[model samples]
Target chain A: MSTSIVPSERAADRGALAAPLDDGPRQREARAGRRRSATRIALGGALPILLIALWYAATAFDWVPAHKLPSPDAVIVAGIDLWERGLLGMHITISVQRVLLGFAIGAAAGLVIGAIVGLSRFADGVLAPTVGAVRAVPSLAWVPLLILYLGFGEDSKVTLVAIGALFPVYTTVAGALRHVDPHLVEMGRAYGYTRSRLLLTVQLPAVIPAIISGLRLALAQAWLFLVAAELVGSTMGLGFLLIESQGNLRYDRLFLAILALGVIGKTTDALIGIGERALLKRWG
Target chain B: MSLSQRTTTLESPALPVSLRGVGRSFGSGRKELPTTVLRDVDLDVTAGEIVALIGPSGCGKSTLLRQISGLDTPTAGSITIDDRSIAPADQRCAMAFQEPRLLPWRTAARNVQLGLARGLDRARGAERVAELLELVHLSHARDQRPREISGGMAQRVSLARALARGPGVLLLDEPFGALDALTRLSMQDLLVDIHAAEPTTIVFVTHDVDEALILADRVVLLGSEPDLPGATIRRVISVPGSRPRDRADAELGELRAELLDGLGVPSHHSHH
Candidate 1:
């Protein structure tokens, strides 16, 4: 009985060893993963396509008045009109510039202040309550104060967007740094790593995922505050286009501006998403 | 051969560790009462010696190892390596924790390089890391992340990382406590082989009596008396064998029974 069982087990073992010679399962898994992502992309686009079709049908049938809801073609024509006049490019470029500048300045300040507060109990105790109270004030309330100090030019608008970008990054970074695995930090200390070296080698790497998420949230916030900044007072931006088109009773141009805002916001978000994936692959 | 003969034969780079009246207590704040963990502990480990610290649960064996590694300060006395007082994270010592504590993002080779002395040149550091990885039988896993490896393999990486420092004293705090029984036995043999290859002063904490007998030249038992507030050295037994002793030797069996009895567990002979 033992001899028969051993022979069968050896055959099974040989079969298992021979299976991977062709790399069968691994290739199958890669194909399956590609198929799954393809399916995901199709599913994500399905709703948008259906909604566009419904809009076209509604307009073609005169279901909603054209004055209130312009046809998709009309919005496209308005966009082309603005592009021909050079207004569309200036608006997009100015808006993107404001968002990027505000995000860079605010995220940098957040990271530095967050590191200080996270690593030092004294700083946290002294600064936390005041920062919390400041954050509690509605972001819109900062609009008047920023304009009062920096005037109605690009400075006031950029400063408002910077305030919007700061808090999320500060909160997430400070919280993440506070909770970086204490065991790993202890190991770093055991290896004679000095304080700053320990922070760089262990603590910062451990919190890279949190930092990226914080940056993503801050980017979204920067866009929100940019609209607020431009809506209050400005000459050239998608937000200014919103007020202008509405005042002139050009609903198609208003729709064009809204669509432009959505596309640009999503495009910036996807850019950060790409960076997130790469950073996680390296550090996660 | 006896331990003395073996020690005298090798020109060891290992450092001797001396603990004099060492003690530790926690929670000395105004709002909290002080709790003593270790008190009045003293031991002198010779260079190139393998000493195993064995004790019951919560007996401060790990805390004592920390004091020697300079990862924690003793509230009472002093610990010196090679006749010099230990500093915080002293360069003379390296430690492998119970959990491996490898940086999850770094490959096995990079994690081991973390142990290299701060100012060492790049080429020598890389060479040292490669050699240590080979020593721990993990050269094949040099590029694998900690999460990609098994627990036993990660522990081996941890050991390799500790050895990369070329420390005069190596400290281990139950480094094999999390591994399976078979893996634990193999790791014990690997450790013996490592010591033979590059003899260093090793102080390890373990709860396994048989493991202590198999590896240590001297086994130091720590425990607390009924009236004492904290644990201290209760007995220091010198095993009668050289490196890599037979696990089933009669002398070791008797000694194991005695050690078990000292730890408040009944031996098989005692039951009979």
Candidate 2:
């Protein structure tokens, strides 16, 4: 890629000044964003750096017990130990499976109900008010009631995750239909489309972006609720490890559990974002 | 409100559409705050004739075209199309807009085929689509997605689509206004050729006077909202000489000047 042999004068000038060569439009945009993100991340590290400095200072001055606030070095050791023990993978797998299953059930139920509500005044009148009311009640509020029905088991966790996942799906579908462009629908009518065909073709195509957005939010929420639900006397989950480690004063292990949660959550979130970008490229 | 109710008011022959003293004001039962978009309008559009509508921006030309397409009804005066009030089953009119609004996900052939949905059985649909692609000289690009084609090609496909329904009337709302000069001229010539072959009745709306003079059988000018004859200026500029009419022809230049003068737009901004 040396520019010494370049014939063009503009290229020679650009090369002499060391102006960075750019790729295609998409690659150029991605490189620009990557640089910005790197800069921001570097600047953001300063605050955390200061906090770590203060904590180290406080521990060195014997202001607090070392056991109480485990050294960052100890947390790193514990993280490596857990990684070797295979507990990290097992916990993550369980959480992800619960989230996916729960998300699937909620998405299907919510989509059906949302369509019914969107299309029919009768369904809206009968179901919307009740669902709205139920959605207002937090997942924690339902913990006691769910336990009564399904006991302190996977059933209760799945039910709670479903509860958390349902509202986004319902709102997105109903809102999308309500916002479906009338002009597009007019085009459909002019094309001699039947009522059902209008829904299948024009209406569904217009709603796809919103539908994908809803699915992403629901999946993320399901994971959030699954971990929260797992916190309730959970035997073998990241959340259970987190709670149990706290009681045993194994601060390093607790931090490791929390770190594992953050890492896995971040990875799943990134994957969802990547999926959204790829889907939007093809459809949006 | 119903087909039976509208029958009494729908008899006319010369103009396929005639709105007599039409006035429409939309509001939520609040007369004091009514949005009077069109008023006391009388217009006549003869069949198989291209009528170019020229006016200052925001003169309700698009709304008027919508009325002609039977997509909307006038609030006061009666609008009759082919001696029948516009109904849900009416399929005699088709429209093309500024952007070539082809379904992005569908192939070029499928988009043209969308217009022929009325009679398509699987194989026949594909065949009809192929025939239309040939008409637009887009046969080679039939299987390609809309994203794969240039702007001019997309527009040609859109025209083929509008013709797919066998529309007796074609309504174009600034269809080529978005194209570059070269592509625009190409499309204009293509449209003239297509119109000459089939004689599809058209209501072509453009701010370009030369465009109107070249394609229109008559150039009608509507004044600013709240002015009348409702159709303020009407000139029958017969496109009689031939296809590929010389742009330098004295008759065309004169008509273009008159159309620009009528619409009160300077020829320099539009003609060139």
Candidate 3:
């Protein structure tokens, strides 16, 4: 509704400003919109700032033992130490590469299989139940079984991430197909669009908003499975860094690793969010 | 007509349509009871003729139009265009539904180009799209999405899209049904203008008696008495005049009253 209201009001104000009259009202309206958005952003940022302040106070005052909870500055120093030793960047690169590869493989399979199942009732009946059952099992539960077959290698970790990413994309696409407006389908048929043409032009475009959100969910799952995979059986990655630091009782490095995980997770999700916003602006 | 003139018109010929004992029914299978929507309807739409189908709810006006457009088939009858059986892939016909049904993702111009999908080359399709948009007075809204425009503007885009394919038979299912009274009036005028510029055999469906009188060459009322099971052509009243005439014409008022009577609805207006 904010979007709906803003454009029309701006248009009205722009038109009024074109005429020979006072521009005070238009200026005030523009200022009010800016002021409201500013306030909203400030309000949204308040909780995180407050939490960080509490963490800093608790750590700096040694309210929690220094060994148990390191100060923020200590974690920063640990980050600097890793950076100086060239380990931080290497770990991040490895994790990012693994996630990207796994996500690509998963998404490609989901796109094709989801479309087939969505469009064909026979495929839905035959394939859906088996997929649903497999997906219902927790993603991490696959780790041990996959390790047994593929061994503790990059293959097992990447495959685990792929499995995690696949189901969300498939389910979202299939659900979107089912929910497409019947009116649009009728219109397409009336316009003489063949079945394949209808799928590409009308059905696919309509499903995009749903698919973007689904892909974002899948990416989040991919990250989760990556960390877990590394924790169980990897020598190089963020998860490995975390377990290594914990064993050395270097709380600062452990905290640093956790911070890196949070930052990377938020950054990737935000990137997807940005893409979703752009898509919805056009087609949502 | 001269040879050149005749050839020009042949490119987009207004093909005549005929319905023989056209009837449609639904739900005739296991765990489903049969219900008839139309029964033993017979009608003819001459080349370049604009006929309006009007009736109350459950009168099957839309169902009839769908059958004519080859979007649906008759259960117990036949429909033909230029005396040949209608085909599913027939490019000779285009239809507009009660709802505009423009794809929300595409801009108004792109949506219109959807009608030109089959044969026209890319350049020709784009050119035709521009021409059609201008015809419907929507050239200004070419790049705007459906949600950004007003309802009347969106409906005009739908009309332009229907015209983009150069359909010989243009079928409209209450195209102006969703607009307000003022917008509906303007849209009706726009439809008249489009029909004049590009003559096509049109079969329009509406519930408005005045709309039927104002636009159609002939109005077909498709309903029956309360006890009747299915609707047929109760009456086909010919409106005798050129279109773009005054809506307040004395002859149209009288005809409106008579048509209302044919639909079993009493007319309530006082003649001035």
Candidate 4:
């Protein structure tokens, strides 16, 4: 019975495959490519769905203690409890605002300083070593110094995030600006562009793709430092929620906070990806 | 009206160029010996004249063109355009390098606009860019980026950009050397047409002797003498011709042979 069923299934599969081949090679390829991506997306979701199912099963079957690992439903209920109290939205908004403000400030400073060091040999000689040394310091190490100087308020937190955002942009922009095609720069000079005009017209556009990548890296750094900033001394934020829930032994809320951070970070990164695609279409 | 004639009205009057004892050398530092590339080079280019500089490879022909365009200063002499001393990045001259060097992000029309005189009103600049694209027969490609175009088309856009500057003297450093043979011939003819229309003083460096014969009013040869430290003008031959000269003309063929011989290449033509 199994052998008979196998032959029929093989014949049906071959028939389905043959139907698309009759449409011409290009159309067939297009269908095949679509099918491939669809399969990829399905495969990607499969593991996550399986993990969630395992979590539900373990909790329902009492395979794990509830104190240590909460069920998926318990985490969702914790999220709703915070939402009803209006704390979840506030935490998310404050964290996002901190990241954005820090990112903008750091990126602007990076561009200006990077241009200076990149364009002028004298500036590069004077500043590059010091900048490199500073960049070598770990992200967490800046937390104490920033806190000491700026205090444990919003100033310290934002400053820490800004510091985190700065190094990536600076390094990428400086390196990229230095390596812009010499032929193009010479062409700009021949056309009577010099100083600022040369930078704006030729140098900047030549490195747009690099600049965008640097910005994306800086954004990720911004989020990282935001958590560090909130984790250490913050009164509110997702990071604060993590610490507070742990202190209260609310494991469900702790898991909720972790999930929120993961989702938010992924979403922001995806947004940057969309912007990158649009920019590359224009400038690439 | 034809494109060239219509655009000619916008061009600046051609300017004469004179070089006196022009020379260039590299590495004149305290610890390093200087290497001369060109020494004691002198030439006079009349207004509206087309001169071709030809030589063997690494013979300083391009360095000479750069000196004239004021992109590089001669270590030992004075160069003047329209009796004014040349300065760095002089407004009197514009140059097109061997490579098209178009900015990849910019459209062909926008690249041409890069050559417009500073502070020109927006409308006039756009008008001039359009005129130049038409002059190069690149109006259809005006909206295309550099990578989207073929080698020959990109070079044409580069030419249009240089022309848009309305320069008194145009300097080209083997501008069509990268094109295929058929495309190069067309480019040479197009250059001749452009010259006939605008009459700008053009000084171009080329490796092809036949190309020099077809395009130049005078071909100036630069080569290193047996004992000399650097290259200099070795021979100047007058190409007796007019606009749109026949490529297969017997006289041009003879001149081509002479030029090839001067550059130390044996021209297989048997002497009678």
Candidate 5:
């Protein structure tokens, strides 16, 4: 929405009323805000540094057995060794590919199905209950069954990830479409728009924010399922590296693999956030 | 103008609206009590006549307009335009509501184009839209979305959209109600100008007494009677003289006082 003068002036009045009887000067308020955020940032950084220091102390004092938890330097060395071997790049690429493919399939299906059910009461009554029942079954619960049907190959892992991604996208998007502003619908009718035209022009644009949000959730779920799916008979990927390192008693490599997974998940989520911002700026 | 032909050709010549013994009620059923909003409302707006329906709140003024436009049907009697009953989807009666109600996502120009009936080609439609924006003094805001424009500007866009269909009858429900005082006066003048340019049978609903006397050929007062079955036409006062009447005319001032008196409000100026 556009911030028109009347409403903004009213909002400013509200802010003044909510403040103390004597409010601070504007410059003082801005300086105080900056100081508060600086303190917050310092506090936020303190915990991670303290945790790392604790880990180092534990290792330097031999408080814990060396085999159980690797030192930070040992994990860094393992990371360097994997990077030198070129295996890290290959595993990361494979994992990314699996997640992307599965997410794309699942999101496409969800969008189509959600549109159908969200707009049609008949489809909703026929299909919604069944989908709800299926979704209640856990994502990993489909792993062994999908492998039995599709074999322990890329197909089974991808299917598992797709299954994980589907429900969030479908449920959220359908909910968004169902709750579209009724006034806009009435306005469309007043303009003499046919039902299909109204759906495409008014309803779809109104629900874009929700659709973007659902896609983000689906992508995150797909990554989670991908790792779980790789636990079963996968020859390559971060998940496979995780299992291999554990079996060989290589704690440093195991830590390195886990750290890599965390970083990749965070990076992908940040990318999705950037996409959300751009979409909102354009369409909102 | 040929390309912008109305989808439905109204059978009569420059159709004037006629509502005979029309009464409307809401919520009628086995379990629900029917509440009558308009009762025995008889009104005949001749072609090119600007009639303003004025009343206190809940006096069924808007309900009457809706019945005439076929947006909602009357329960008791029939409403006819050019001696023919109209349907809800008929394009002969176009309306502009109190709120501008322009689609938020569409630009001002595109929103105005929504009023064009089926057969107009792209070039003609665009031309018609540009002309309408210019008429409303919104040529600069054609590319702006609804949110980018002020309330008065948005209302002007909505008025342009209503006129785009070349509607035989125009219905307005407090079209300038949301505007500031200065904007409301300017918009009232704009309405008079638009009516002069394209003369159509207009039914305007408003609560503003001076506004009714200023723009209308006749002022209709619907009395506010809460305990009655519904509100009926209390008075229909003719406004004398021609177009572009002086806003400070002594005759209009006297008429405003008379109209206010009909609504149970004695005017201070009249007493003096």
Candidate 6:
């Protein structure tokens, strides 16, 4: 690319030129900005550290009863103990497995539903209202109905997670399709794409960023709902461990379980985000 | 290429679009309150003819293009494409609007491939995509998303997409109007070259008089508000030769003057 811009230029000539290729001060400011943002990100990261430190201090000084609040070290010890017992590993695996299963089911169903709702007027007319009404009801509300119908087992929990997970995928797809530039749709139409090709290629791809967002939300819900669904009805999974700990009033273990859930959720969300950035790089 | 040169017989070919006394009214049919968008719109876009539609905004220029592309039907007349009556799912004619409209989830190359199905097999589709990306000078940004490119580059990819299926007719609605002058000029040159090489029937719409004069074999201007009942055949300017059609020529200036006056803008407004 051409670099450097000569100054003896009038505005008209400058307009004729593309935005300047190079500027010394501009480059310096850009470097300064990179440094500033990097510093800010580093500094901002410490707030969490400070919060943990405060939590430790409050516990160390006995500001609250040990039963009421577990110290950071106590939770860490509990995490280590649970890991040593093989409880943490097994529960994490089960939760991950459950999230993956429910996510796949919900996301697939949601994608199909989204394409239909986005593409077909008849399909949308038939399904959108029903999906809308169903979405209004939280996935937790279905627990009672599922338990009564299928009883407290893995099926109910998985099903609940799937139900919880489905709406976001459905909504993201629908909204994305709705908002997809008519410009692109027109481009698709002009290219002589058949109906199926239009949907699978143009329609589906156009709505994917939307679908990806839904998948992330669905994953979170899938993980979160797994815990809630596992709470009363299960002998396995992290929620069972948490509930069991709560009953015994082993506050440190409860804190550790809760922390583990947060950590897992955050990590999984970050991974999905990574997947999205990768896809955007390739596709976008 | 002229309309008469090409062989347009398809396996299931029928009359493309023959608008018989086709006119459009924008409001309710009751009373005289309906705003007439088009009147006595008698025109037939053949299987392979690039007919440029030029007019002022709100003169139903876009509406006319939409009718031909099957986005809507004329209020009073019928329309067709590839012999079939116009429907929402009709695929005879492809269109690209002013915006690039690339799917953010697909790469620039894949965005162009959105139109390559049925007619183009896998290998050929890949070849067409490569050729089109090259044509648009965007293979370097082929892996980038729409957000990563400039407005002009996105529009180029959009053009590539429109050309992907070897469409019977290609419809463009102010496709390059969004770009800067230099970008617009380059895109115009690229469009002319692609049109020449591929020989696809192209109907390019734009408000720029120079753009219409430069790219189209025939420029059909849509008349304005208070154009009033009877159809106005507002000058069909023809300038056929090569790229960068002589901007200073007397014939072009005369035509530009008349068009600007009809559109109620001063002739000086043409350049800006």
Model 6: docking quality category: acceptable
Per-residue lDDT of candidate 6, residues B46-83 (tens digit):
65455677777777777777777777778787776655
* Candidate 3 residue-wise lDDT, A1-284, digit = tens: 35567777877877777744445787878888999989998998898889888889998888998789888888899899899999999899888888888998887788778888988899999999999999999876888898999998889888988888888899999888878998998788788776899999899999999899889999998998889888887889898898888789989988888888888988999999999999999889
DockQ, 0 to 1 scale, candidate 1? 0.65
lDDT of 2: 0.75
Which regions of candidate 5 fall more than 4 Å away from where they truly are? Answer: A1-64, A83-86, A121-130, B1-14, B82-84, B224-227, B269-272
Candidate 6 versus the native: TM-score?
0.76
Error of 5 at B245 (Å): 2.7
Residue pairs with clashing backbones, model 3? none
Ten contiguous residues minimizing lDDT sum, candidate 1 chain B: B3-12
**Residue pairs in clash, model 2:** none
Name model 1 segments beyond 4 Å from true: A1-30, B1-12, B30-33, B270-272
Predictions ranked by lDDT, top down? 4, 1, 3, 5, 6, 2
The order of the candidates by DockQ, greatest first, is: 4, 1, 3, 6, 2, 5
How well does candidate 1 match the true structure, expressed as C-alpha RMSD?
6.9
Best by TM-score: 1
DockQ winner: 4
User: What's the TM-score of chain B for every model shown?
Assistant: 0.93, 0.83, 0.93, 0.95, 0.92, 0.83
Candidate 5 residue pairs in clash (backbone atoms < 3 Å): none
Better of 1 and 3 by TM-score: 1
Better of 3 and 4 by TM-score: 4
Error of 5 at A106 (Å): 2.0
**Candidate 5: docking tier:** acceptable
Worst 10 residues of 5 chain A by lDDT: A185-194
- Per-residue lDDT for B121-231 in model 2, tens only? 566556656767887899999988889999999989988888776576788889898889888887888898877655767887888777877777777776653343233
Q: Interface RMSD of candidate 5?
A: 2.1
| lDDT tens per residue, model 4, A1-284 | 35566877877876788765556687878888999989998998899899999999999999999789999999999899999999999999999889989998988888888888988999999999999998888888888888889888889888888888888889889999999999999999999999999998999998889988999999999988888888887898898999899899999999898888888988888898899999998889
